[model samples]
Target: MYKLSPFTYTFAGRSKAKKIFLDSTLIFERNDTVAIIGPSGGGKSTFLKILKGIIPEYSSGKLEGEVLFNGHPLSGVYFQENLQKILYLFQNPFSQLIYPGTEEEFLFSMENFNFTREQMDREKEKFEKLFNLKNIWGKKTSELSNGECQKLVLASMLAIGPDVLLLDEPTAFLDPTARKEFYQYLDVIRKDRLLIIVDHHVDEIRPLINKVIFVDHDGHITPGFFTKNNFVVEDISLPKPKTAEEVNVTVSDLSFSYHKDRELLKEANATFKSGEVVAVRGRNGEGKSTFFKLLSGILKPKKGQILLEKNGKTYKNDKIFPHVGFVFQNPEAHFFFDTIEEELKQSFRFLSKEHTVLKDDLLSRFFHDIDLKKSPFLLSEGEKRRLSILMTVFLEKSLILYDEPTFGQDQKSIEEIIVLIRELKKLGLIQVFISHDDYLIEKIADRVLVLEAGRLYEVPRA
Candidate 1:
């Protein structure tokens, strides 16, 4: 059992200024499966970090509360004695994964619990089958996709057999089928353990959650009820563009391989037109992200060419880097500046004179709640994602690629992103994104492409 009495936390901000992040009293008993829901940057993740004792230890913050574990105050010794029993899965898998290879990472936590060699092997096999991670067992951490990394981390935590598992946006990167499978495994283990989840996909896990806790923008908490009838999704519609036949980018005879024996893509060809939104969907390790990287010039193809056409001219993949804007799946990968405002300014420098007005408009729209002076790295996962997308827009590139643009986003934020994508299409800008959200694909995408057998195939619309 866990309990927090009149808890409150304040994060130290720039210039010695402090902002209250959380102020609420909560409790979790054994066999309690609770879901935390709120707007983006509403202290959902912060509250979880406080519960896991990560705020003061790993981050700079002030805490004023009494946290009890097993009916006693949580001290250094008390936390250590039950460290193995309490597991916290971070929002970003790269932050928690330490081992070089997937197999080693999966076994690292189990080995800490003194499991026998034979036991560890059996556990690894079980999790590999459950999460479909056997294919990536030998892959290095850096080589895995975002979805693959998420599955590996979840499999490793489940292998540890903890009594309390705190998962932050665990299914953010998983596809539809994989997300369902994840919940199936969680259902089995949650019967005898405490499962606390912070996710934006409330509808997917509605059947499994018994109670809901809503955190608001003002650091207030209130108990809420979950009802299927209350779910409402708005339909997104964009105005037609003046011209939609202009070819934006073309990939011809593209081939790429991470290893000599395994070919991820081979002779793949596709053409994207301006004023269109393309949604890339496929299973894990199917090279969706790889294709995006090739188009964005992050990775060069082993054989073949990528051409970007704009203003009656064709540019090679490498030469068109300035014309392409890519929002990585991990927002931190796209950040380089010390403060959020500086990141926006760097992108503004690349914008044309006609689009300079968008700088202030986007800043006030996307970052109204965020502090411009604060470090971009210190924001929450959802906040980081919003800032990253805004910066990419400021660049005013001809082609924009977003990888999992809706990951860790709440309902309102997701709607706002959809509106932005629609607006981009109306402006004759090419938008290609990789996402597992069916709603996003159905509402915004002009075409859906699935990667199969090292090639791209268009899915017939229903």
Candidate 2:
């Protein structure tokens, strides 16, 4: 059992320090499976870190009140004794997966708890079977896909037999089928343990969750019941195409492979027209990100041509950089400036040389509540995503490629993105994005491209 009595946390800021948690009280029993819901940058992740005793130890913050574990205060001796019994999984698996190979990572976690060789092997086999990670046992961690990384981290955590499991967006990167499998596995394994999940996919996991806690913008926590009506997705309308037959980019006989034995894309072909939103949908590790990289000139095809046709001129893959803008799946990787404002200004400088620069008021409207002076690296995951997309849109590229645009966003942020997409389409810009969000694809996509068995097939919009 765990208890937090009138807990409060604060972080350093420019004018004044900001309070992330405002004297909140929460309790978790042995068999509780609770879901945390909130808006983007609403301190859900911070609350989890606080519960795990990470805020005062690893971060510079002001903390008050007591966090007790099993009727004892969490201190040096108590925390060290119960370290193996509590586990916290980060939102990004890359932070938790430190070992080079999967096998070493799994073994290292088990050995930390003094598991014998035989016990380690037994637990490793059980977890591998449970998470379906046999195919990636020998692969390097860097080479695994996002979903694969998530599975590996989860397996490693479960191998230790923790009494409490704190997962932050465990299925944010998974495809639909993989997410269902993960949830089913979690449901079976978390029967006796305390499981706390902070996720935006409320509707998908409603059946498995026992209680729901809402963290509002003011850092107040309120308990509620789970309901299917919590999420209401509306159908978004996009602008009509200027010319239905105008092809902006054409991929012909494209072939690519990360390894010699595994071909991710082979002889794939597709066409994207102007003034349209094209969604690329497929299973996890099915070359959706690979296709986006190829289109953005980040990776070149081994055999075939990717042509960008604009103003009666054709540009090949290597020459298409000027017309293409790419927003990576991890938005933190796209930042290069010291501050958020500098990052946006850098994009504007690259786009124009004259006085037609983007105004601060317009930029402020796009990032309504974010601090412009903060470092891009310090922003929350959702804030980083919005900044990344804003920079890409400022470039005014003829072709925009977004990979998982709504990964950690809340409902309001998603609605803002839909409006931005509509405005972009009205400007005759070609938009092609990879997403697992069915609602987004159904609402905004004019055409949906399904990548399967190394081929791109068109599916009718719903």
Please give the clash total of every predicted structure, in order: 0, 0
How many backbone clashes are present in model 2? 0
lDDT of each: 0.82, 0.81
Q: At residue 182, give the lDDT of candidate 2.
A: 85
In model 1, which regions exceed 4 Å deviation?
A: 14-25, 227-247
Per-residue accuracy of model 2 over 162-223 as CA lDDT, tens digit each: 99988999898888888888899878877889999988888888888887888876667677
- The TM-scores of all predictions, comma-separated, are 0.93, 0.91
Over all chains combined, what TM-score does candidate 2 have?
A: 0.91
Q: Candidate 2, which segments miss by more than 4 Å at Cα?
A: 22-24, 225-247, 350-368
lDDT of 2: 0.81
**Which residue pairs collide, candidate 1?**
none
